[model samples]
Target: MTPSESAAAASNDTRTRRSRLLDRVVGSLWPSMALHRATRLMAGGQAIRAFGLFARAARAGSAEAEYQVGRCYLNGAGVPVSRADGFRWIERAAARGHAEAEWILAALYVDGVAPCCDRQDSSGSPLDLFSFDVAPEPDFAAAEKWARRAAEHGSADGQALLGYVLTFGPKSMRDLEEAQHWYKLSAEAGCPQGAYGYGSSLVQSGDSEGDEVRAADYIRLAAQAGLSPAIYLLGMLTERGWGIERDQSAAVQLYRRAAVIGNRSAQTSWGRALMWGVGVEPDRIEGESWLRRAALAGDADAAALIGDIYAEAGALPPNYAEAAIWYRRAAEAGHAAAARTLGLLYLSGTGVGRDPREAMNWLGIAAEAGDRSAQVDLASLLLNDGASHPGDLAKARDWLERAAASGNLLAASHLGVCLLEGIGMDREERLALQWLHQAAREVVSAQYWYGRALSEGRGIEADPSLGRAWVARAAAAGMADAEAALAEMMVNGRGGPKDHGAALDLFERAAAKGHVGAMYALGMMRDGGFDVASDHAAALRWFEAAAERGHEAAQHIVGHSPQQNVRDDR
Candidate 1:
């Protein structure tokens, strides 16, 4: 043969071999391809003619084809999805040993896919993922069996799933050791999820035992792999120093990274850090920005934080109107703090109009959700009201007690007052004093009460010197009542040596800052000619100012004064 003819012959042989190889590969893939096409159609995504072909391949005992076709039927590809048909085909493929089918079945059993056909109903120990689903009765129990079989066959996903099932199955099936074995197997296969599960299993006993470090390590690995769950877990561990040294800065960085990827938990944590300056500088604008973003994304924690920031005034406007609006937004999202704030606004005419009934409604929701602030506020509302208050003093006391249990000093202080006043409990002077002491150690209001009670001998022995010292300490700590009492004692030489000039200076300063009691006190001093050369005109001026500020006694005094009548006629 000529050299050209020889080359041509070689080329033709190569072409023939390539064509045959292509045919073989296509033969292997055609069934799954057809199923993929059917799935697209049923998903309302894309329509094609591969649905019938998939059905044909599935019925012919091709396990790969059965798995693919089952997915389509399960998802309503081309036709309406039939849970019954989907389960049947998948089960058939799984039984025939299709690797993918086995894993898919395990997912279904864990996720609680609805049963549309008698086949799934008949063939399985019907397992619902949660108690919310109805338990099945036919009792094939094949799901667990198949999952174990797939795990035994070395499917990492199957092994992880089997681990979970064994750990949490009904009493008859629960076996922690079996779960641990499967989880370790899957983790050894380089499954990050499996590693996380194994680590969590180690901590089930609640002993640190280095399980936290191991869990954090696995969580970091999973997060690096772009698993949202792992990302959240890593942030949690870092923030809490759980199983490792607390590294808030590192946690914040991780939270930011996860938040950028649309993780709600990360968003909430990031927002909190910005709000509180925890491992970051406090930035109200930035904090509110993150919180708004998270709240829009449906994060309950962020919503609650936003409500808190808007309700309490500092740098933000003190418009209770706007505060009420934000509180309502958060309350609607099931944030108890927000609900409590909303209830407060209603109770006190804060950012919203006062309505005791509405306050009770929102406060009740917060109290039910274990908000300490809500408990105390709700208790106060109930303890002071008539039948229309909507809550009994016993219930109020219960709420207050719970708040006290949570270590809220204000709640403890108020609770002490309730006991002393017989508002919620009998007057147990010793118990009330004990609670007051506890509260005083934690809060200034209690400190003021302690001093006042000691001064008046209310439920305790009166000791003027001790009262003076207590009130002085409270005054230094910025309590208005303490300041007034101490100022009076200073002028009269009751607690300590008289300092008349110093008392005048203190009263003037307090009056300038709008202290009603201070204004009234200064007016009396001037009227009595004890502190300011008997200046009745100046005394009348001070009284008028106090009266304008809603001091009822000052108003009455001014009304009886001849100067007030003369001014009214003018």
Candidate 2:
């Protein structure tokens, strides 16, 4: 069976939902051969997708199938329309009490497409022919008549469609209570489209809306049936723990299904999940590919995500050139992150040529958009405090305050530094410590600050062990100051131990990761021959590396010449 047909045949799956009743399912359940042929014709009789079911329905001779066939004829599907034949099939189905057929026949009669047609039923029942015209209200009358019949016959799709037509189509055709009744019936009958439409309609335009339980059930059912819209919403709710517990797994599944079904929003969301390894295995290539697809599809958020992945470190890590590309794309797509990153690239000469003016422009856009990070960076630039950007302390503080309030770690860290140094502001130990602690959770430099605070009892109780632990973590993360702190502790047995061997190993690792203190430590290590041969040449080289960074200790050791530092005394 075609996927569409399979979808219909699996209606009892109790998991399917969608905006419309699937034609394949209609074909499978139909009992009129002629009508089945019509539905098949509507699908162009191709063996591509959704074809097998139409063929089966055509073979079945079902009423609904016949109605579909009639629709195809009216719309000229796969062949030239035969108005007479269209009316014939519709009339035949309507006589069999097919509501959809009745509606179609009514439209044909109203449009005067068919005339003088005799109506006959499968059971040989006959009806008197009447002149119908769009001007005479018979079309609306017949539409309502057939809708009532279909709805009364427990056709969920009919009920939902009728409710939609009644609620939104023509003002003269509107019926609030009737629309509500049909929608309710369809929802109860497990119609995916009906449930979502009803739920949205109920809560639309007002705060007094949303039956989470009812909506969740229908959304879940429809999501299972591969309904993209419902799946996207459900994924959002689940991810945020809004109407359900934060279920990364469920969210990922919803996103995947919707994305596969060509839901633009879902594509971005699913890509993000894959990229972040939130509820699925991290797949950078796939994630990036999907995100690109979404961005191409005009999804702003997806564009922004691609930009973020490229410019800043995330699930796939960072690549300045790739990030530059993504950031530019996103900026063009009107994403704040993209704009900010563009500015950053320009200011820092990262992947893009440095242009402080362009950077200012992009940052200005993001700052106006209320991006806390952008605000902080831009404000700092205005105040001339960070990364060679001009300084404006007051303006910078304003942005910093916003960022700090919104829990931006970098902003908080910068704020703490400002307070501690009394730079462009008065000292505020308590607030500075709080911000430092917050930033310390993920920032090595911030951790060092907090560690220093703990060690000095600044704005908090002194705890040497706590301080040491924080410093150790920062050292492991390769922070220069932290590495120096740990090395000193190891050498002096201040925190926990005095292991020169351990200290030397840490120094080497940190040096490899680009910690300047670690380089100096390595120089000292070579000078003392702690773990290697007493090689004065190597000692001089190590000292030279640290000296390049203007390390005072290394400079003093190296003195005026590399040869002199090699120690002929050895």
Candidate 3:
């Protein structure tokens, strides 16, 4: 054996051991050193170098570095954005028990962010390397799992997010009591979202004054922290005097603050206040601008309110065309009152084409939504079209009954007429009289009908004097039928002394309103000289007018002899 060769081999082995020891020492300290350098580079805006260091640390199994690298990919800090890579890295960090990473994963799953490819083109623009057509759907179960993990690990942000998910998640997953519990814990840890959530819950479900006051306190805390929703809610509570002094002016101020930050509901309230000068000087232009913003954002109430403002004669002139536009928008979004108003516009040809079909469609929509006025209007339209649509009469009666049962006096009047005339059902004189009597207190037409019933003894004992008094009352209110009836009673002396001059005057008044019966009576009176000077030409003219209006007796008289003076038969 050569001693020199053995000594050289031993020296080589010692050098190898020393190099191995140095490599182990460097590996032990490299990740920590690289992580520190990355943080400093990030703070210095050296994103490219920071990302390199973060990548190195991540390869060494550093959770913080993995999270940072994920964020860099997500935000395009050092490279083109890539949500797929970002989510992968974040998921890895979350699996390693990083609380913040877990929370991020939970939020990402709940929000359903796009997961694009990791590739970049020569111009450094993101490319769809995976050819993905759509973003992945939200995974609520995964979100809950990550959120619970982060919350159990003492992350206040995670607690707040968990509470939100539990409170407003899908119907099957909602848990208000558990949500409140998480919110309380997070709020105690100084999370503004947690405070707002807890306060909203207490406000909605508070059982006592103390709970309401506590809710107000928590909401105030969130408002002071600049939470827009909390600010808006506090304004509502202040305006309504719920756990606070009523202060509409102060509430308007709060609404203004929230509105400026793009809260749609706050914008609506602020616009209403400004438009009506409820708690501020009227500013129609500014108010309408705010309302339009909310309406464009799909606020149904705001759209409907804008329609009302344009329709009403206020600071601005009424513009039914513009009102119809807004009403159509709100009605399409299921606003009942807006549908009803739009129906009336179509029915009357006011700022819209006169479309009976459209009117019935919109009126039916509102009626089905429980609008009593809509039901009554729909019934009237149906009844008026009975000749063309024979099936409509029964439907009209059904609608009238519904509205009348809901205490609509006009509906009761219409329904009573239908019963008495056998238009929709068998004649029910007793029911007709009862309904007419009930509606007569507020309805002029009902008053005339009730008077007629009393005079004819259709459903009650005849009381001609009382009937004459009622007809006189309705006549003074300008009812054409009532004027004619009262005039007949005066001429016949059925309930009072006859006054031929007064009866002539009453007949003339009713005829002016196009009452065919009044026209016939006037012809007879003039022909017989019962109320005025006899004039054959005037009698012929009155008879011809009544005949044109489909009066059978007047038509017969006209056919027999237009110039003949007929004797008064009354």
Candidate 4:
């Protein structure tokens, strides 16, 4: 043989080996290639051809082809649906280590769409994504078994899913500690859902030993990975300065980003921020629209916000009826403020019909939850209506004392009145005066009682001059009783100097407010010419007006007076 012939023979042998290697590799990939072609054909509407190709490839033991064939049979895609055939094919592919096929078969078994497989397929148990709920009976026990198997096989999605199933599954099946282990593994493997799950777990652990810091770190990773819930949670933490610096503007932006991706919590929060100008310019109508979207998605907070918008009379055209409806919905969903508002509305007969029992029921819930305003209102109602029942007054007093201790001035004043009047308990005059004195500095009504007590020496040393000054202060604040008391004192020179002219002006002012005593005093002044020129007709008119209003003294005088046509000895 020649040298040239030898070199050509060697090249041909090498080329033949390379060609055979390429053929072997291509043969191994042909099933996947055929499945892809079939998918394209089916998508292009050539269903019959696609079905034939898929069946052929499936018969050749192609796992991808088998999965496609199973899905087609199950859903009746260009063929009569045959669940049994679909199940058989999917199970076969799953046995051959097809991840998607395994997931489908597991879902079928767990959901009871297909019979449960006890120790079945060799390629790990059935593990499914919850997003695909093609059917509905859930067997968490079977799901747990299958998901654990998938996790053992090093599937990131399977590990994450296993963690979630175990974390939130039936109490009997839940193992939070084990679930956290799987979540950490899946998160390290770069699964966004896993990171989110791990973050949530750490956040809920309530262990302050670096857990919050860890949670924030994982949550940030998940949010960057585009997980909606993680984004929303991160926004909340940012807004509240929980394990992060408070950045309300940044939180609003995060909420908007998550909202755009259809996160319900983010939608509600963003709407609230916009409505309240919390970190953005107020846009009530736009905020309302977003809140409506969240409410439709079953967000209780959004519903509560809508209720507030309707209930605020000065902020919007008051829609008490609509407010009641939203408040009821939110209250039923366990919103504390909504429950309190609903109770107030019921008590006031603003939106719903007056129903004191229902009002008390709602208020009771809010009071138990530590709402200060609810405590005050509940106490007032109980004191007014519970006076006839033994021990009920004590309960009312307890509530008043609680509210007063919480720095409520109105509650303090009311408590003083209850002590002084002995509405439901024995009167304690000294204690009443102490409370009255405390409230008198801030409350107009309290001033009257405190001043009267001082003047009459009811519970304290008599200080008529100081008492008159206090009464004058209350009268200036528009208390009709204080005005009448001060006027009489001035007329009689009881506390200070006699000033009938000043007394008559005070009497006229009180009379203008329909104070019966002031009207009778004005009649006497006119009849006697004490402060002004006597006018018989004017005196008769004032006395008659006072008498008509059930003034006994005025009535007695009117009854003894002569008729208009008769003469009277002056």
TM-score of model 3 (CA atoms): 0.75
> Cα miss at 146, model 2 (Å)?
37
lDDT of 4 by residue, 322-380 (tens): 98998888788777788889999999899899998999889878777777778777777
Model 1 agreement with the true structure over 1-570: per-residue lDDT tens digits: 999999999999999789556434544567555455455544655432345556655755678768767887787765576777788788889988876688778777766663534333355755322223456432225557777878988888788878877776676887888888898888888887787678667656446647667776766767877877677777888888887678899989888888888888788888888888888888867877888898887777777677667656786576667667767877887889889878978988876778989999999899888887888888877776643443476788888778787788888888887777777567877677777778988688777777767777778887777777777787778666677778888888875788777777677767877789999988998888575577888898999999999999999999989977887999
Better of 1 and 4 by lDDT: 4
The TM-score values for the models, in the order shown, are: 0.68, 0.47, 0.75, 0.63
- Arranged by lDDT with the best first, the candidates are 3, 4, 1, 2
Best by lDDT: 3
Residue 360 shift from truth in candidate 3, angstroms: 2.3
| TM-score winner | 3
lDDT (Cα atoms) of all candidates against the true structure:
0.76, 0.72, 0.87, 0.82
Evaluated against the true structure, the overall lDDT of model 2 is 0.72
TM-score, prediction 1:
0.68
Instruction: Report how far off residue 470 is in candidate 3 (Å).
Output: 4.4
lDDT of 3 at 397: 82
Q: Over 4 Å off in model 1, which ranges?
A: 1-54, 60-66, 74-88, 91-159, 162-182, 201-209, 235-261, 267-293, 304-366, 384-392, 402-407, 487-520, 529-532, 542-560, 564-570
